[model samples]
Target: MIDPEELGRALRATLAGFKVPRNIEIVDDLPRDDNGKIAKHRIRAHYADAGARTA
Candidate 1:
């Protein structure tokens, strides 16, 4: 498994260099249905409604 702290630093570094509104969203585990397909709608809602929910 990826180290959460290391991943956070790397992600922050990468996002910091980005210039597209600087809106970065990261999630540990995506919401999925019983079949395991990602629930894009839920992810979108979460991202859209509350900015980025960081670790």
Candidate 2:
């Protein structure tokens, strides 16, 4: 399995600090809309509290 921390380290090494994500979540599937597009609102709402805590 890919290690999220290791991936984060690699990204930090190669990308600008502002371009790196503050959080990493691994899921089986993302919530999708009826049209099969990613449900961005749902994702944001779901992770809202987590983001708040981190911030």
Residue 47 of model 2 has an lDDT of: 83
Q: Which ranges of candidate 1 are over 4 A from the true structure?
A: 1-21, 51-55
Candidate 2 weakest lDDT stretch, 10 residues: 21-30
Please give the lDDT score at residue 41 for candidate 1: 91
lDDT of 2: 0.90
lDDT of 2 by residue, 1-55 (tens): 7778998999999999999999776688999999999999999898897779989
For model 2 the local lDDT of residue 16 reads 100
What are the candidates' C-alpha RMSDs? 6.0, 2.3
**Candidate with maximal lDDT:** 2
TM-score of model number 1: 0.43
Report the alpha-carbon TM-score of model 2 versus the true structure. 0.74
Ten consecutive residues with minimal summed lDDT in candidate 1?
17-26
lDDT of candidate 2 at residue 42, scale 0 to 100: 95
Q: After superposition on all CA atoms, how large is the RMSD of candidate 1?
A: 6.0
